[model samples]
Target: MSERRVLGGNQHALPASIFADDMSYVALGHLHLAQKVAKKEHVRYSGSPIPLSMSERNYPHQILAVEFDGSNIKAIEEIIIPRCVDMLKVPTKPASLDEVLATLKALPDDELPREQQPFLEVHVLLDKPQALLREKVLQALEGKSVRLAKITPHYSQREQQDSLQHRRLSEVSPQQVFALSWNKKFDGEPTEAIAEAFETLLTQVEEQE
Candidate 1:
């Protein structure tokens, strides 16, 4: 019987002391998938009981119940729990906003947990006029028990590149381009003076390195 060691499922092997005669079961965690390690029968990993992200939507949520016989491992049982939250990734064009809202409203409330339904991440693919999809979704879900975890807006680099192509080579300074690009990608006012200062500091540090 080894000392009970809880570890991530992605890790390999149990310590020698964990398998000692007087030791008990080793309960592991993480790796979002429940599994037994080796033939020892006592080492196990209990995955997340709920799907915390869109990538884990297919995984069943469960809890592990282990019974120990004194200092020896007896039986390990997996208990499946009903999912309290549902994670959905819906891709929509700008024109489909109304339809998307309708679909979300039509989702069965019975399937959702009473406490709070899982967070939903909406991926918006804008093919038409620009609109604040994030603000719209947040407003729609407001007061509702369900939480809108995030709204991701997808943009095409080709469209931006094509727009940039119209600018004359002489008109597009590297510093200006950098400032424009950085300001667009990140939320904040970026000034040429600040950019110059950062560049000076970066060059000084690089020289030291």
Candidate 2:
């Protein structure tokens, strides 16, 4: 009665409390990543047979076969499942539409079965919807064999900086706006030296005016 947990085939439904020190082995699902839960080797998730998310695509899907010696777990073996349909991400993270389109168009054709062909997930960093957006993506994939499963448009940190740049100077504080501009240029926070430099420039401009 130590390990009251059983193979949870569904995702995210397995409660951690079900795993106890006395349990010989546990098999769980719902979480897409193969991981040891609660720091117990006997407790684990087999993950999905195929990656359900873009993040999980790098790791191989596995099946766990657990052996028990008396009341203790002997060993846990992993059997890798061959991937049929691949899940891929364009531009990896949220990127400009142009970069995403270029990645999609550059994808080499894979002569697999239509059902086994890779599924692409495009992540675009866009502040607002563009005209004929889906059409543009479809056009890019015109000759590609990959299936366009999802097009996730995200408002990224770069987009925030761009928005600040477009805003009126009177609408935002000088320090805040300048920091945003600095982040946009450097891809990081403004340093103390940069802040002093900005302040010095502001003082000079004010005196000149």
1-209, model 2: which lDDT tens digit per residue?
42214423343344678777677777865655567876777777776677655545556788888878888888788999988777877765567899888988888865667897788878787767678878999999987888888887755556666666678878866766776667668987665456546755554333223
lDDT (CA) per prediction: 0.58, 0.71
Candidate 2: TM-score? 0.59
Task: Candidate 2: list runs displaced more than 4 Å.
Answer: 1-21, 93-95, 125-128, 154-158, 161-209
**Candidate 1 segments exceeding 4 Å error:** 1-22, 30-32, 38-40, 69-71, 88-102, 105-114, 127-131, 140-145, 154-209
lDDT of 2: 0.71
For this target, which candidate reaches the highest lDDT against the unseen true structure?
Answer: 2
Q: Residue 154 in model 2: shift from native, Å?
A: 4.7
